[model samples]
Structures are given as structure tokens and as C-alpha cells.
Target chain A: MNNMKTIFLCLAILIFLVGGVSNAGTYLDSAHGNSTYGVDRTSTTQYATGHCAHCHEQHASIGGDEPSPDSPAGPDDYLLFSDNHTSQTVNFCFGCHRGTVGGYQTGGLVNRSYSYRAGGWTSDTLDNILQAFTYGPPASTTSSSHKLDDIKTFITGKWGYTANSNPCIACHNPHAVQGDPANSASSAKSSGTRGYPVSLPSDHADKYVWDVYGDDAGEKMSNYVYQAPYRSGSTSIYEPDGSTTTTDGTNLTDYVTLCTDCHHYSPTPVSTRLGNTNLRDIDWAASVHGGKASWSKTDADERKLPYKAEEKNYVLACTDCHEPHGSPNYCYLIRKEVNGATTAVAADTNTDWDTLCTRCHTYTHESNSCINCHYHGALHESNPNQPLF
Target chain B: MKKSLIYIVSIIFFIVLCSQVNAEVAGNCANCHTMHNSQSGSDMATYGGTSGNNPCLTRGDCIGCHAYDTSGTDNVVNIDGSLVPQVWHNGTKDLAAGNFKYIASNDNDRKGHNVAAIDPEDTAAMFGTNGAPGAENALGITAANFSCAGKYGCHGDRAVTDEIISVKGAHHADDGTIDGMSTGTSYRFLKGVLGLENTNTPWQNISPTDHNEYKGINGPDTTSSTTTPANATISGLCGECHGYYHGTNTTETGGTTSPWIRHPTDFSLPSIGEYASYTTYSIVAPVARTDVSAVSDTVNPGGTTDDIVMCLSCHGAHATNFYKLMRWEYDSTTLATALEGCNVCHTSKN
Candidate 1:
């Protein structure tokens, strides 16, 4: 019994370090799994004992249940402690981190809850229409989770039904994962054969090239992208700003093409990282890093940016100006400056619709409302040169 | 016979004397300066004494016809003594008084005239406030204020050339012009009261080589064809001034690119369109957004290529309606229509 106690304790510590069994299980090779949990020579089963269940358990749902099925008593398939799909702590990952679990909640309050129906997500694009961190009444399974599941079921079931399909996890993690996933595309490899649709972490080697945009759905699971002047440049490569490129991995275009699962604008070979289906999302349209227009881009004429055409080169990606998933500002995105202040430009305030307006700050006009400028009155009615309504 | 001859000689002398005085008033400044050294001063009403610096003008020289039109001419400040009533009209002569001739000051170089009007204004501030000077606000010309709400173009009119004009006066005078002054093609101080000598033209044809593609300083490298005019690359010339419209949310207004890249009228922007069919129970979808894919409703982001608004169609440098300084009548909204702006001139409506 003493030895058994030691074994369980060691397994618990191992699970915590590898961020639970879900990821540790992904590295079940001769090199990683053995080192993490000590190989059970008697059993080398897939999804054995130490997997997703070792670290996470969904419970105390959005509203239905309090500490619903709290651990030790969970489900069979994915280790759902309860209906976390509908938690007041909307973000399943925020439950333990945002001061919920005792003794383990010490790294300051991590506000992880997000509104799936706000701004770009909802019908209201107005700035004051809603708040960003309003702990919405525990997501009634009907409003949030069901809508997503229903969409996901259709996406996984059909190939090309809707021009603009709503694939649930297309932009989401569902697991509320923090930090990097081990089998992350960086260290992943393709495990399954080509043509069929099964991808293991190792199968995703980084040869992410493309004829027309890209074709990676798992790219969202990775943290790298190509940083160049033109998105369509021949020299484009997968890059995640602040990281270096490696010739050691396979740049799999097939896996990255998965991004198109939701970017259903057209019928292209490769899927895009942005929403526009037929056309690109205009990422390079105004993507400047740190809000300064003079940045290096492979397609840019130069970086000395004058006040007009190609005046300042832009760097891009949602993460360039925002947090991992979403933020407090407009559409939960990021920007360089806000409402005139420069220092601490990106994070000074929540990314709001108004914050988005200030991104093009020097633009002068009659109202602070974005509708007055970009949309400006009604179509064909408002004068183009003059923005005054 | 001797007595009749003496009467005829006296009559001839009177005719010659009268012609001499009329000739003096008809010519340009040289007419007055030709004899400024000896004047029997006449004005006791509105004229101030001429200083050595003002050799071209004399006391009350502009008092009669111009006296009422240029209410502050030679001595007063504004036209009606009230700045609000300052007149900016042109083409017609400044003849509110009984005498009505071109009442321009003898010396346009304000120093040659009176103090009521300011000496000069800065013209760079008028062209969209992003640093592109336009008609009437042409640089190197004399203006009254740097912040003149210098107007140009009109809204809701078909495109026209040389339609731009300018308005002018002195200090205590209006600042910017409601009409255009010049567009790299025109200049101030033409021979006539109005510039260009009345041969109409606002913006002049410029060589891209002489000016920068985006800065209007040096020409950019582009292929030219017989069908297209010389130096007619849209990127080089058009972007030098309207670069603000092209900047993304990340870029500030006035930012430039080698080739201009304007916004394609979408949701990320305000509802500002030529005529919006999107308000108050109008089931029109919103403008398209780059980030948004799905929405509460499906017909979102409005239309893309078929129904989009571009910068060139709705705007012409020389055509407009309001104050003759805009491109369209945005204030008017004809309901339940695709409206106009982008779809107007680009009639690919299939």
C-alpha cells in the first residue's frame, strides 16, 4: 500500500507538470510519454489512464449545476465533469484559475469568461451596446453550447453546404487550454496517412506552403504565421511573430487548410486564416506592428512610409494587437493606440469598438461614432469626400 | 471773325483738358504711380494718409465705387463693419457705391494698401486638413489665415472641369474661399479680377516624373500607353492627396502607400454612404466586415464586388454641390434604394 501511494502521488505530480493527461497522452512515443508518466510496460494503450482526465474536469456549469459532478465522478468520452459547455465561468479553463479551486488558485484572478454574442458576434456593433466581461447568466445550454454543437454537427457531417458555415471550434479551443499544447504544430508530426481525414500531432510537420492561401485548420492550434509585406508573396512562410522559422519540420499545407472550415467564402484549394472566403481578410491591408507603419514586409516597396501610399508598412495577425482568444476591447481584438494616448498603447484600455475607431486616429470628422466615418450616413447618399452627415 | 476764332480755341482747350483726366483712371497701377509725387489730396471722409511704403495708393483712392462694396476699403476693416457680413462674392465688380469699376487695391501686396485687411493667409490648411493644398488654397499665393475653412468642390453634381474657384479680400476679411482658387494648374494674381484671365481651369496636368508618386515630389516608375494620358498612373497622382481614405484601422489618416489602397466601403466603418438603405427597419444587411463570418442574420456585410463603393466614382476633384466644395449630396436620403455612391458611374448592374 505504501508503494502504491507513492506511485499515485508521482502520477499526480507528473500529470500536473505536463498540464494533465490530455496532452501527456499526445506524446505517447518512446521519447516523451515514458519520461512524463513512466511507461506502464504492461499497458501501452492509447488514451490509457493518464490523459485529459488527469488534469481537467468540467463542472458547476454555466447555471444548471453547482460544482456539477465535481471530479472523481465524470463522464466516459472526454472527461466532462459536468455540463461545462454552459458555465457562468463560460471559459472552461477559467474555472480553476479564476479563484475557484481552493489552494490551487493563486496566480491572480484570470478573467477568462467571454461573451459569444457581443459586437462582431452579436447584432450590436455599437460601442455601448454591451459590456465585455459581464458574467453572463450561466450560459443556458440553449443559447451558447447548443448553437455551437448544432453548427459543429453539420460541419463535421457535410463537406460544402453553406458558403459561410458556422463550424463550432473553428475559432475556439473548447478546452480553455492555457500556454502551448505539446503536440503543438511546432513539435508535432503527421501520424495518419494522406487522403483520409485523421491527423496526429506528429503528422502536422510545418511544410505549410500553399498555392492559393493555405489549408490548415490546426493552424489555430499552432502559434506561428508568415510575416511579410504581401500575403500573396511567393516568399511567404508560416511564422508566429517573435518566433523563428525552422527547416527541420514539414510545413504541412493540408493540415493548415483546416482553417477554411469556417472561412467558407469560396471554393479554393487552400483555406485562409481570415473570414473572407473568395477574397482574403485584408490582413495585410493595414497590418502594422506596434501601430507604427514602418515595418519589414517581403512585399512592401520600403518601410520609410510617407503620409500616403505604402507610407507605413504594417505587421499583423489577431495576436499582434490582442490576447490569445479575445480581449476587452472592440471585438476582443488589439490595436496600437487608443483615444489619443500613445504610451502603453496596446493594453491601456479594453479593445472596444471605439478603440478600433482610434486606430485610424488622425482621421478628422463630425462624430466620434464609427458609423459616421467608415459607413458614413447611407450608401450613395453621403458624400464620399465629405464625411459630414 | 477774330472774336469767333477766340471762342473756338477756348472750346478746343476745354475738350483736351477733359480727356486727360479720364485716361488717368482707366489704366493699371502705373496710371496712379505715374504721378503719386503730386496729388491735391481730396478725401476728408474715409482715406488714411499714404505712407512712403504705399507709393501706389493715395488718400481715398478707392473710396467712391469700391468704398461701399469693400466697406472697409482704404481704411475700414470688414465690408459691413461687422465681420459676419463680410462679402466673398467675385466676378461682379466691387461697386456698391455710385461709381462701379474693378475696385481692387492699387497694390495687391497688402503693404501697398490699407491696414483694415490682413496681409496674407496660409493656404495649406484648406485641402482636407491632411496637408494637400487645392484650388484657392494654392501654396505661395497670398491668403488671410492658416485655418481658413477654405471651401472647394460641391456635393451631388456630375463631374466638371475647372469648376473650382476662389474668394478673396483683406484682413478683417473672410479667410478661406467658398470657390476654388487653383489646383496645381491655376495661380493667384492673374491679369483679370478673377484669376486665369477667365480661361477656366482648376487642377493642372502634372508629370509624375516631376513629382513623387505619393508625395507629389518625384515621378514614380510606371508604363505609359497612348490610350492613357502621360503620367496617369492612379497610384502616383491620386494618392498624394487622398491617402487618408486608404489607411486601415491600424494606420492613421494621411498615411500613404506607393499605390493607394482605399477601404472598400464595409461594416467596420460607419453607416456613412451616399444613401443608406440600412436604417430604421430597413432589412438591408450591414456592410461587410473582414473579421466577421457568421452573424445574427445571414445577409451580412452588405454586398461585395457587385454593390461596393469605391473612392473615384463618387468623388471628382472639380465637381460637387454644397458650397461647390464637395462630391455628393450626402444629406439627402432617397429611401429603399441601393442609393448611389459606388454604383453610380460603375454601371455593371447585371
Candidate 2:
């Protein structure tokens, strides 16, 4: 009886271990794992894309030689070539995702900005991620971007960020990150690939879901209330590809909900680029751009054609006037192009709002006057300060 | 003849029952075990070790199979059809027992258990004597006897001296439920210890709903010299080696009651006051359950039999990135933001 029981238990244990087989379907369909253009798995003609060897070196060295750009100390954990991150610019993911300088880039890649990709706005497509982050310095001096160092520090302190972790993983799940979808003219103009690129930063370890921002019942724009903005001249056609129908579900992503995962009411991060000043908290649900808020005592006649079409009551997505990555126009990541217009919004001093704000509203007031009452914490501020400290 | 015939029928019934059970370690046998340790004119041993040196016919040693030096962000990796959990992972998500990544990276003794095979002994003043701080007088855990597994260590048979030999047959043994009857059936292979193993997330990802259920006894009576008590609790497993920490000796654990010297273990959480707010189980400061049959997402604290304070509530079993292997930033957290690890139970102290 004892021996029979023992045999049964062994069989059970074996079944349990085998049950942990996970699929790489999400990664296989991503841009980095696309076999036709992805990184060389073993060599030019070897395993190719979708192979685990592209990022992971299980034996520490490949073909009896260590992989390039490895840490001098030793091989990194999880058999990666280098550490996850060492500095703001020195991230492991940027090794292949970067373009032109500092980091190497794999060929046949199409990396575009959020405005051009998702919003269907005419804007400069970024060559690499480094180009996006390096917008403020030398290239477009006064432009602002998300401080990677600040993200690294904040996430490390709050989350379970280890020595080998990359801060980018907080918002981006590399394995399951999708690209902008096709059909740029549809209101359902989804972001590339099938899955959503961004994730809830706090829930960093959750399994990557393919359609996190899908057009499903509880997904994408359906999770929140939103109204699609109008195109430049066409009042019938809406933004996100000049669609005739407004995308309340199935196509548009809820940028307000996504960005506010970190930029919301509390735990405001201190930006290293901004001399350690606390980032301003945003209450987008109560803002004028948010459809629920009152627009009384405001000039609707001063608005642009797109704004005039809806009388400035259409709820705005964060990408409606801002770029997620980096932008040529400073104003703290204000989009270079807005409402399908070709004319680029010029970069100005931190206080100036007309360069970007005037794209939708014809504000001829003082440079910083528009932001005084039209900001995130507008009503509560005793003294409204400039953006980016 | 009738008894022998019945035994054959019992064996057949058991085989069918075993076929339906889920196992912990599976996949190709050659992935872990090697008959000769040689493959296709080249050595097949992992962790840079020679072919035939590893014990139990394994391709790599304990640390070699469990951990590796890497900068990648993976807590678990696929090893030939098997998902192997890493103890020294570089990822943000460490397993429930904890990670040994800090021991090699930081070289700080306080960050991890100073396994002799992984790193050297603790050179700090408190452990400079080469003896564990809270070890019992009879079984003094010195540097000479310390290792990952042996008679002196946590895992495997305590009666055996050889590390690999102590845990022989454990990996292949049938570990259905943690009954603590055998080494493999024990909680995480800890001999004679009982607790519900976290199968969800494979012990890598932890949350309020998904985590290990630890065993504990409410209100431990320890006024005399009782070192190795067969309590079957998770705290009792720690007390088997570090006995003084769980005792009530005035010079050691101070007193068992409120105005105590050292922190108390095997005590029930008070339901009233700020502690009551901790009705939800925290992955940071986890309380042990009185009943280890199942894992509870909620905590019934303050005079309840559930939610017993254990040593793991304050410290990790293997390693962490904080000083003293704390589950949180104990050294850096201030009084203003006292809602971290320690303040979870001792609410008013903040």
C-alpha cells in the first residue's frame, strides 16, 4: 500500500512541473521577434527572430565567445548580455532599439512618434528611442522629455527594482509590446501590432495581455468616457485618421487613464532634469478638456476650426495636444503637430503656451496667461507656476 | 494467496491515481540528470564545472542549477522543456523564499544568507565569532559547519553531513501535499516542516492573493531552555537552527510579553487599533496562518487564531536587497512614512 501511494505521488509531482509550460506567442508577434526583420538569433542565417537567443545567452557565451557590450564584472543575471540599465542613456533595450548614435540599431525597423503613429497627426517620425529622449539637448535645445534617470530612481524606490532591472520595464513589457495597427483612417486606428505597448507601471510583474487596449467591452477607450476630436478642416471626419465615426470603443486608447497611472493625484515624482522639483499632479477628469467640466466664462470664438466644430466640449486624449515620448516644440512635451496640421508648433520658453496651445485655441493673451487658469491644479493654486519647474 | 492478490489490485489502483497528479519537476530526464556527463565529444556540465564532478549524476551543482550570473530581468527561465526558478535572479520580481542576487552584487553580508558555496561568511562584528548569532549552545552554527545544505543548514536531512547526499532522491520524490513526512513532501523541501507551497506564479510572482501560506502557532510558551521543539510551524523550522531568537531567555529574546527586548515570534496579531486596518494580507509584511492547509488572501487579526506573527514577517529566508535581509527599506524608512514593513503590525509605533 505504501509503495503504491509513493508511485502515485511521484506521477502527480511530474504532472505539476510540466503544467508550467508558457507560450511565447506575444513575443513571437512583436517587432523585435518578427523573423523577417528581427535581430540575428545566432548569426545572419541562423535561428533569426522569435528565437530566445536574440536577448538571452543561456550559456553566458555564444559560439565559445562572449556576446558584445557585456558588463566587465561578469555575465548578467538571467543570462543577458549586459545589465538592464546603468545610466539614463545606457539601457539594454536601447542596444537594438536605438538609432544613429550611442546604441546600435537593427535594420528594417519603423519607429514613429505617438502623434504620427496613434493620433494620425503629421509629425516627424523618430529614428530611434535615443533620438526621442535626446530632443532637449543640442538637437532641439529647449525641448523636454521624460527623465529616464528619474524613472529609474522612483521605480527602484517604490517597486521591486533590482540591480539587473531596467526602469523602462515599468511601463513597457518588451515581450508583448505591439506596434501601431494598420487602417490609419478608422476611428479604431489601434496602435501597432495587436497588443498594447504600455502597461500599468505599478503592476509591473503582471502577465502581458495582448489586447489590454483592445476595442473590447472593458478595454481601451471603453474603460473611460471620451469623445474623438475633429480633424483640421473636415468637421465630419474625426481625428485618429479622419474617421467619420467617433471611437468610444474598439480603436482609440485611453491616454488619460494610461498617463495618469503615474501622473495622477499623489506620489508625484521628482524630476531630475527639472532640478529635483516635484511633478505637478493632474486631475484630468475635472479639466476643461475633460467633457464633464464646465466651460462657462470662456471664449469659444477664439478656438480653432477643429475646436469650433465641437465648441471645445469634446473630451481630449492626452495625445490630442501632447507627445508621449519627446517633441521638437518645448512646452514640456507639447506635440509638434496638432489636429492633422502640417505647420509645426515652435518651441518657446517654459512659460509660453501659445506656440502649442494656439494650435487649437487662438490665445493672444500674455505668454503664461493661458496656463494660469487652464492648468491641472488651476483653481487651487495661489500662484500658478510654469511647466517643467 | 488472497492477501497477495489484493496487494496487486491496490498497486494497479494507485498507478491510475498517480497518473492524474501534477508534478513539480518534469520534462526530459537528461535536462537535469546525466548518466555519464558527456555529450557529443564535448562536456555537457553547466556552471563551467567539469563533466563528472557534480553529485547525484546532475549536470550542475545546486547553485549552478538554481542560479547563474546574468544581467537579464528573468526570475524564471526555460531549461530545455522545464521552467527553472532562479535564486540569484537579476529581475525585479524575486521568488517567495527570496533571492540571492544581492549577495554577489552588493557583497553585503546583511543582504543575504552567507552561504559558504555562494559567498564567504559574515565578517561583521556581530557574526565575527564565526558562530550564528541565535544558534543554540548544543548546536553552534560556525563557519566550519555552515553550507547551503547539510546537518547544519536549513534544507535536506540534518543527520547527513554531505550536502548533496543529504537531499538525495528529494528532487525525484513525490511531493504531493506538504505533509512533512519526507524531505520532498516538506515545504520547499525543508525536512519535517509544514506549510502550503505557493504553486501559483511558481513562487516567483507574489501578491495579496497569490503567495505562500506559512505555518505558525499563536502565543508560544518559552520561559525555559527549549531549543529544538517539534512545533511543525514555519517559525519552529527557523528555531531548529537559530533557537535563541525564538526563546524567552532574558539575555537573548528578552521576554515573551509586551515590554520585550527582542522582537517576538509565534504571537497572534492584535485586531484592535491600527493593526485592524491590516485586514488584507500584505505581500511585504506577510503573517503566518495558524492553519496551513490552504492560503488565505485575507488576514483575521487581533484575538483571532489566524494571522500569527513569524520571523518571516520581518526578514526573508534566503536573501533580500535590504539590510538584515528585511522585506522592505527598514534602514531608510522614516517616521513620517511609517506604513512600511514593520508598521504593518506594530501600527502605533510610527
Candidate 3:
């Protein structure tokens, strides 16, 4: 019996050691799973690193006490401490991920707005995730946000999502989502790693690779047959900040494929900014902005930098003119800055579309408002033969 | 005196209880077996009723028992305190071997191995039968004639043609520890294959330390055996049906070095260059271990034999949502369009 006991103990020790070295699930590598600075900061047991208690309350309690005030009464859905979502301002994630930390939680939570990281706009004021989502007035026509309530409602009805679940989860898996580690290190606008933060929501569970976009082939903009745009005003500088050498978009994310997963011709979501379902469809393939057609500005002088020759055929990244979360700009969630220009250069009134258009194209056309002739179906639907200037 | 006797009795009871709990299959005989086909004036078979009386006088056949209907939220179900892993479940989570539901779906022949009865044979013009795509032309095994056990299947004795007889007493006689000694003691009952079975969680919710410990070798010389070799490895077991896929055989795999004809398996990942970046083990693209007696989750690449690539590095054993049961979306043209699979290990190729 003594010999058997010793053998059993040895086997148990072996199993434990082997399992410990393996490091286990993908969540352990995520930002939330970081040992020094992650969800464990909120753990009642300080050294319980990467424990599920940060998000899930197994028995609707924590450390032999009731959960924090942010949480709902009793065991919440999925054993989450708080209700998945409550409202635009009272969402569960806002407890820690917002600009202002709640009294119950620890402070010093830092996050950079997407515009600053991707567009190199140093003047971006949206410091946290919540501010970016609620940039402008609720349902305002001029400047619009992603509309969290609308997203929550749509996902619940269509994808059978649980009621009040965080709509942000529609695009981001918190457990497996990667964070901008560079942001934690410094305040530099262009310091971000440009990791693929947003998982394809339709295939959210399938996400495996991240942070290797610059090195990988298909994930980078260079693989899209792209011709890099120039920085605003400077003829030699590139669009992704002031790179002297011309590029084939080696430093841009393939936002076209990621955004088009939902914003395609048929199954496009209802547009909150336009206040209509009919305004949703954006078939990039058939449009002048998308692939399949070349820019038909006859004179090279008429076009701006990067479009040196006539009939330039190049695919454009969606981030070239738009902000992902929201912006303080006047129309279409347009960027506060574009083509590495000074901040707020693209902000304009509804009629003043040239402010955004001239960031890439030369302001030579008669109409200051490009939308009058360059609507979604203008060139592709009305006059297929006519070339875009 | 009385208190000491009580303490000693309690200790012995705890030991006996632990031993009983470790038994692979411990439950009432009637839960699985049937003396006669009649029970409470009805057939004892769990599926298809009286008409589907299975061989070996068991309650159900392989699919009938293993693929028992779940709550659409569970991968495992308890029958008389005996835990059973489901291969066809609607739950969000699936076991390590994967689920068979993908292949059973309409027009999804490439999604998985299309077993007979459970799944229809491939009807594509290229494949009149459900023959494996990369399999050698001589060894004929197709979906039309494939089954859950015996000659054409993975589990139990491959030489035996009878499904029930091939895996005769495996379940009842299982001792839990898998030493590759017999059908009952083999890893997941894969006959002669050697591995450490994750008995507690089975194959569901696997972690690096808690996953099956697969057998592998560094710089393998498989020139001697044309068929699945005497030394059993997980890759070697797969080589039984798909010998062409096994990388060690010089004739089958062209050559062991780079600039190869066929993609190599059972080959050590070079520690230097891009391969070294994969210092951590990824469940998405798992490797095998040189020593099955111990396990390590970290990858040493060129430094150790534990970084040897196997057939499973690219494919799932049962099924997946991707084409040809690939672990990742191989058909995606752009990385932005879908998740990376081949590039997970190839590192620089993406």
C-alpha cells in the first residue's frame, strides 16, 4: 500500500507539472490574462492571476461577500458580476474601460482612441472606449456614433444573443482580444502595434492570429493590390504619417474585408446616421471607390500626390476616410484628420464635402460638395461609361 | 481505543472510494447491457427501438450510444453516473476529436470523414464514392463502406471485420491507465496507440497540461516499416489508413530534407528563424511529444523533439467547420477575410 501511494503521488505531481508548463488556453495570453496588469487587479485574492473571478462570479458573490454595486442582484447571466449591458452610459464594461473609473474599482486604466493609433492624429481627445462610442449627441444627424443600443437590439433579434449582453462583444472577444501594449508604455500617437483588435463578429470564434499583420501577407494592405496614398499637402510623404519612401500600403490594415462582412450589398445593417434602412448597402466592388474600376481623371496634374499618372487603379482601405467608433466631424463618421494632415482638418458642414475629398484628390472640380455627384450609386449605377475625375 | 479504530476504518474507506472512482467504466450492467431485447414490454435498444437491436447485446451501436442526443448545450452526458462523450452535439463547445455534425449536414462532404449510416457518401462527380482525397489509390476505403469500428474504422482491432467483436470487452474491462497494452488500456481505445488520456475532462476544454500526451520521436527513421510501424505514435496510427501522409518514409515522403515533394510530418520544427518565434504551444496548431511518459506545453522547436509536427497539426480527427476538416480556414484568400491556420506554424509564409 505504501509503494502504491508513493507511485500515485508521483503521477499526480507529474500531471500537475506538465499542465503548468503548457500555459493552457488562448485567454492566458490575452491582455485581460496578463499576470502583472490584467483583470487580476480586481481579484479579491491579489495573487489569483488570470482567475475567472475578474469577469465571472460563480456563486453571485466575491470573497464571501456580495458583489460590487456595478453588478446586478443574484447570479447574473453567464455568471457575470454585472448585467452584460444596461444603457449607453451604464454598460458593464464602462465600469473599468471608460475614461472615468468608478469609485469601487482601481484607477489608472488607460486606452487610446483608434483615430490616434491608426490615423496618427495626435489631437484625438477621445481617451477611452466609451467616449469613442458616444462621441457626438445621441442619434444626432451631423455627427454619429456606433449606436450601442441599436447594435444590441439587432444582435439579440438576429443572432439569438442573450438580452442586454455587451454589444461590443459582437466585434471583440474580451477573453481572446489583444490589447495595444504600446499604449500602456507611452503617449505617442503612432506607437500602437496595429494589431487586429476587432475579430470578425460573424466568425468571432474562429479568431486565432493577431498582432502579426505587418509581417503576414494577406492581412496587410499591400496584398490588396493597393497603391499607397500620400500624406496631406506634402508630395513626398506617405499617407500613414511622413514616410519619405513611396509604399504599396505595407502599413495599413485590410479594413475593406473586415467592414464589408456586414456592410455589403444585401445584408447591410440599418444606417443610424442616415436614419433609414435603404442607406445601408455599400457594394465596394461595383463602386468607383472599390476595386474593379480605375480613377479616370484624365490629367495627372488634376490628381493629387500618389496618383502620379492618369487612370490609377488602386484599392482603398475604408479607414482612409472614416473612423471606426465615431468622430466629432460633421458627416458620415468622417475622420477628424486624414492623410497624416493636421488634426480637425477634415471636419466640415454637410455641404462642404471638399474638406474630406481634397485630402486625397486635388480640389479642381467645380462642386465643393463631392456627394452631389459622387453618391453611392452615382458613378456605378447611373453612368457606368463615365469615368470618375 | 474506539476512536482509533474509527479513524483507521475511515482511511481504508477513502482509499477504496478513490480506486472505484478511477475505474474507466463503473456503473450498473443494465445501463449498457440487455439480457433479452425486451425491457418493460419494450426493446432495450436506446435508439431505433426494437428494429435496431445491436450486436454484442448492448443497448445501442457505436453511433447510437456515442452520438446520443444531447441538450444542445452539453458535450458530455451522464447515464447512471457514467460519463459519455458525444460526437454529434449541438452545443457551442466540442471535444478535442471534434464533432460529426458538420459532415452530416447537407452538401458538406469535405467537412469531415463521412461515416456510413450517420453521414451520406460524397456525391461529387470527382468522387463517385467517398474515398479519401490524398490516400494511395491501392488501399480502398470510402465513405460508402466506412463504419465506426473494425476493418474500415479507426477504433478497436483493424484486422477484425466485425464491429462488435473488434472492440468486444473494451468498455467494461477498461482500467483507466492507457499503456497501449490492449484495446481497453489504449489511448481513447485506439488499439496500439500510446498517449496519456485526459480522463477527467476527456477531450473537451483541453489545456496544454491537461491534454493528451501524444508519442513522437526526433529525427525519426521509419525506413523499415512500410505499414504502420510496431512503435506506436499518434501520427503512426493515422499513417495506417493514409501511409502517404507519414513523413518519415523516404519512398512515400520523397526525402527528409527541405525542398521536399510531400509536406513532412513527424519532423522537428527548426528552432532557429521564424520557427523559434513559436516558443509557446498553440492548441490551434498542436505538436507531438518525443516522450509520452512526460508532457510539456512549451515548444523548444529545433532544440527538442517535442516540437515534431504531425498530421493533426493541420486537420481535426473527427470534423470541423472548414473544408477537408482543416483546423483553420485554408480557403480564405486574405488574412482579413478569415482566421489563419497554415500560417500558425509556417509563421513566415503568411
- A1-389: candidate 2 lDDT, tens digit per residue: 99999999999987776652232244444545444454543232233343445565432333224456655523454445566676655677767667545443334334566666545553355655666777774355567677677777766645445444577776676655555542121223333433456655655533323223333455466455455555544456665644576555345667677777678737787886677887888767656666444444344566665455444445677877777767767646877656645434353433356555666666556545555556665663443222111
The models' CA-based lDDT, in order, is 0.25, 0.62, 0.61
Worst 10 residues of 3 chain A by lDDT: A205-214
Clashing pairs in model 3, backbone N/Cα/C closer than 3 A: A19-B209, A22-B297, A217-B350, B271-B302
User: Candidate 2: deviation at residue B80, Å?
Assistant: 38
User: Residue-wise lDDT of candidate 1 within B219-293, one digit each (tens)?
Assistant: 222221211111222221223233323223212221122111122221122222213333211111112222121
How big is the positional error of residue B126 in model 3, measured in Å on the Cα after superposition? 68
lDDT score at residue A302, model 3, on the 0-100 scale? 59
Q: Give the Cα RMSD of candidate 3.
A: 21.8
For candidate 1, the chain B TM-score comes to: 0.25
Q: Name the regions of candidate 3 deviating beyond 4 angstroms.
A: A1-25, A40-50, A103-105, A139-142, A156-165, A185-194, A205-216, A228-246, A298-301, A342-351, A364-368, A380-382, A385-389, B1-350
Misplaced by over 4 Å in model 1 are A1-52, A55-79, A87-168, A171-178, A181-315, A321-324, A330-361, A366-368, A371-389, B1-350
Q: Better model by lDDT, 1 or 2?
A: 2
Candidate 2 local lDDT, B247-314, one digit each (tens): 55544454455433345678888766446767888888998887877767888877556688888887
Task: Indicate whether candidate 2 or candidate 3 has the larger DockQ.
Answer: 2
lDDT of 1 by residue, A277-386 (tens): 23233222222331224433322442221113354432233322332232333222332222112112232232333445433333433434544433312222343332
